[model samples]
Target: MVKRTAEQRVLLDQIKQIADGLGQTLAPFCEVVVHDLLEPEQSILAIHNNLSGRAVGDPTTELGQARITDPDYPQVLANYANQFADGRQAKSTSIGIKDASGNYIAALCMNVDLTLFRSLQMAMGQFVQTATDGPKETLDPAGTDALRDRIDAFAARLATTPRALKTEERRALLGELKASGLLDVRRAMETVAAHLGVSRAAVYSYVR
Candidate 1:
């Protein structure tokens, strides 16, 4: 192992401290990790929240290797999507740390589990749906088949399949649903997400 200078150690320690604080601040959903670039075989120096099922002393990631091999690699890569071994989706950001000699020494990564947030969103949407009185002849919100039919009809109007609709078309469909007050129905986003073959987060992105 190459011996790290005192200055290098101090820099790494500072970075670790920042990682620790971030882990605490974004607890339960986010995982913060610090990787030691010098030790690729056991690169993880510290980890928090433990979302990805990776522990300290785990092997380095492909991004870590890229930083070592490519001097032109960006110092920060933000808000990219990732997935865990258990199939949970995450929105991740990574920051590469460099020593005074411009060599990559450490990396700070934050991974936020979108699966949990999506579930919470669905629950909240269900809970907050406005109640109405009177006999309405709309599609049953609880029936997945009904929801799928609505999605298919909307997609048909655009001359595309629900799974192949462009982003703008998806947003338009969502807008139409909202205008029709379908979004106010319980679990509507969940059904739409399923019909579109995407996570609820993707559905929410269009709404947002």
Candidate 2:
């Protein structure tokens, strides 16, 4: 049986509001799937898979080919460490989720959307071309789209504040992001850092 929590339902309603507030529809690719990594009871909370109207059993496969990991960004794996470090300051929007005891839960998150950032990527490309070569126009739309998605995911993971974690708390947080489902731990951490308005290097300090 698929059980939906009040939080899950609220999230769905929020997504709807997001669409209405934007004055544009969410890309069919937009979705929200919650995972309870701490459950005794490990289970997928909600898999709101709505892909461009095409049902592709796995949401990850259906979206544009965004790189799930970045070799240059190693600060990602340490993101889960922030869970115990006083999340109040954890600047990442994705880092805001908490468990029953008001502690942050370790989960594979899928709540954020990157439509707006997609626009920014395009603008940056255009800016580069006009500023560099006004006489010759050059911009790769496909590349820009791909980069935008990667940036969004990476940024989301990177944006967060530490939760003032203890030694044991740090260990547990690391365990969560490095879990099986949380692959490319570095990229994920960097994404969280980007969201938190911090440098990836600062996040890396937590892991060490």
Candidate 3:
């Protein structure tokens, strides 16, 4: 193992703390690693939330190797597709760290396992699955339910029941219904009066 300079050692230690904190915060689902680029043969300095089953002192990854070869390699490679050796899919982000001279000295990487999210998506799909070819029916063919729903919503907005609406409120509602052509529906006056707990003549009076 190559000996690290004091500055390099401090930087790597700080990155290990970050990896540990991130690993705990995102626990059981994400893996966080810090690699010491100076020692490519045993690059991995730390690994947290070990999803990929890798260990400290493991060799550098292809990405780390690339950074070792080129100082100008992308500093941030985000949300790329990756997979564990066991074939679990992953979403990965890698950030290359540099020393004062701009030489890539270390790397911080995160790998998020997609297995749980994929399982959740499939379970939800099954939970909400329904027969698309079944006979379709219009339960409210005449839109009476819609009209009743509107009345109930309006009354709810006023913090009252339809049957408890004051006379003026009923008049205003009747005027709105007339303007919307709901009053032209067959037996609409009867429906409105019944919902308002009043006589059909009362509904006519309000509309007039």
Best by TM-score: 3
TM-score of each: 0.61, 0.24, 0.63
Q: Mark the regions of model 1 whose C-alpha exceeds 4 Å error after superposition.
A: 131-208
lDDT of all predictions:
0.89, 0.39, 0.91
1 versus 2: better TM-score goes to? 1
lDDT of 1 by residue, 24-102 (tens): 9999889999999888889999999998888888989999999988866899999999999999899999999988888
Supply candidate 1's per-residue lDDT for 187: 89
Tens digits of per-residue lDDT for model 2, 1-208: 3464677556545544443443233333344344333331433344454322322133332111121222122212222311212222111122123334443232333332344456788999888773545476545332443333543444345463233444454344545544533425336555534543456675465456
lDDT for model 1 comes to 0.89
Clash totals in order: 0, 30, 0
How does model 2 score by TM-score? 0.24
Q: Candidate 3: where are CA atoms >4 Å away?
A: 1-3, 130-208
Considering lDDT, where higher is better, how would the candidates rank from best to worst? 3, 1, 2
| Residue 138's lDDT in candidate 3 | 65
| Best lDDT among the predictions, by candidate number | 3
